[model samples]
Target: MSSQRYELVFSEGPGTGEDTVVVAPTGLAGPGGHPVYEDATGIVRAEISDRGEVRVLATGGGQNAVRVVRVRPLP
Candidate 1:
């Protein structure tokens, strides 16, 4: 089985701004070398760029929570 790694980022807590997390991918990219996503959880949102950039959007209710997801291809 070929395993892959992904990066995650989110906003946690008040004034926390942006947080980061990493997740291992279960499957490879679908096409175009773009990251593939199956499912997402929590207030986490994922974004990817053709320039090999990943961005996540997660906002905490001024409490201090963070979650982020990023997907990338491996060589």
Candidate 2:
């Protein structure tokens, strides 16, 4: 398993303006062949494309925003 991590930034969603969530690779791929990531609670699942396109598959309890403005790699 890779130790790669990512920061998912959400805009105009549940929390305050531009909420950022940290996610790690799930070692699984989505239907579009993109890597899937989930929050610590395993509720928010998203498939982020190479070009920084985020497709949210599942939101823990509808707490995630549909629009993810930015995705950045973590050091």
User: Candidate 2's residue-wise lDDT over 1-75, tens digit each?
Assistant: 233788888787666588789988898888889999888988778887777777877654546445887888887
Question: For model 1, where is the 10-residue window of minimal lDDT?
Answer: 37-46
Which segments of candidate 1 are over 4 A away from where they belong?
1-3, 12-14, 28-33, 37-50, 55-75
Candidate-wise lDDT, in order: 0.44, 0.78
- Screening candidate 2 with a backbone cut-off below 3 angstroms (N, C-alpha, C), the clashing residue pairs are none
Model 2 spans > 4 angstroms off: 1-3, 13-16, 59-65
TM-score of 2: 0.76
lDDT of candidate 1 over 1-75, digit per residue (tens): 123544554554557666554544424453345554332443443344455465433335554433443344543
**TM-scores of the models, in the given order?**
0.32, 0.76
Candidate number of the best lDDT = 2
Model 2 Cα RMSD, 1 decimal: 3.9
lDDT, candidate 2, residue 35?
90
